[model samples]
Target: MLQLQVPCSWYFWALAFGFNLAMHNLKNILISVVIVSNLGKIIRTCTCLYKQDSTEHHDHIE
Candidate 1:
């Protein structure tokens, strides 16, 4: 009985450990994706603003 129980407990612990590791990795991936998408949005917004400013400036000069 002792021998059978030890192996079963070990298997359970291993499964738990793997699950925790996977969740941690998934969280990191989600965070990175959000950060990257936000950065892209910010870059696009800046580019649009810059283009608008340049066009307005040229109009004033003309």
Candidate 2:
């Protein structure tokens, strides 16, 4: 009969690889979310300014 044992070092390497992958993915997600949120804010601000400018123009004509 032959018995085989798994090495502990293999588990250590696997843990390190998983940790690195998770950190990299998290960083990418955070960056994309921040960019999207900022873009939305910019668009909203522009629209508000345009609306105000248009209202002022209409009042001047009246």
Candidate 3:
């Protein structure tokens, strides 16, 4: 009975540790994903604005 108890407690502790690690990693992944998406949106908007500005300038020169 004592031997069985030791392994059972070890397993429980291992499971808890793994769960905590998974949650931490999940949070980091979500944060990175949000940052990347926002960056992509900003870049796309900037490119569109630059294109419009250049085209307008070209028309004015002509």
Candidate 4:
């Protein structure tokens, strides 16, 4: 019984370890995606504001 149990326990531990590693990697990927999307949004907004400002400046000169 003891001999049988040891191998089973080891298999269970290995499965759990693999699962934990996969979840950790998935979390990091999700975080990076969110950060990149937010950065893109911020850049777009800044570009729009800059364009508007330049247009207004040109209007004033005219």
Candidate 5:
């Protein structure tokens, strides 16, 4: 009774849906990490440069 109950297209559809969902989730996660990491690096570098410039400016005035 169970052998004939399942349809052939049902498995294909289920697999395709699951694959699509997995790919979408993976893509979103990759993009988020890349953006966050790059932004953090940029902010840190800017802060370092600002501090160095201010220190140099104060030394030149003395």
Candidate 6:
């Protein structure tokens, strides 16, 4: 009985550890994705603004 109980307890602990690790990794991945998406949007916005500004500046040159 003791040996069987020990293996059961170990299995339960192993499951719990794996679950915790997976949750942590998932959270990190989500956070990184959000940050990357926001950065891309910001870069795109900046480039658009720069192009508009340059075009308007050229129109005024003549």
Candidate 1 segments whose C-alpha is farther than 4 A from its true place: 1-22
State the lDDT of candidate 5 residue by residue for 1-62, as single tens digits: 56555765678788999898878799888999999999999999999999999999999998
The lDDT values for all models are 0.96, 0.87, 0.96, 0.95, 0.89, 0.96
User: Between 2 and 5, whose lDDT is larger?
Assistant: 5
Record all residue pairs in model 3 with backbone atoms less than 3 Å apart, i.e. clashing: none
Model 6 alpha-carbon drift over 4 Å, by segment: 1-20
**Candidate 6 lDDT tens digits, 20-44:** 9879799888999999999999999
Expressed as tens digits, the lDDT of each residue in 1-62 for candidate 3 is 99999999999999999998878799888999999999999999999999999999999999
lDDT of 4 by residue, 1-62 (tens): 99999999999999999888878799888999999999999999999999999999999999
Clashing pairs in 6: none
Model 2 C-alpha lDDT per residue in residues 1-62, reported as the tens digit of each score: 12223456667778898898879799888999999999999999999999999999999999
How far in Å is the alpha carbon of 61 misplaced in model 2? 1.5
- List RMSD in Å for every model shown: 7.0, 6.6, 6.0, 7.4, 6.7, 6.4
- lDDT score of residue 17 within candidate 1: 95
Clashing residue pair totals per candidate (backbone < 3 A): 0, 0, 0, 0, 0, 0
Query: Residues 1-62, candidate 1, lDDT per residue (tens digit)?
Result: 99999999999999999898879799888999999999999999999999999999999999
Better of 2 and 6 by lDDT: 6
Candidate 1: Cα lDDT at 46 = 100
> Can you give the lDDT of residue 44 in candidate 5?
99
Against the hidden reference, what TM-scores do the models get? 0.60, 0.57, 0.60, 0.60, 0.57, 0.60
| Model 1 weakest 10-residue run by lDDT | 20-29
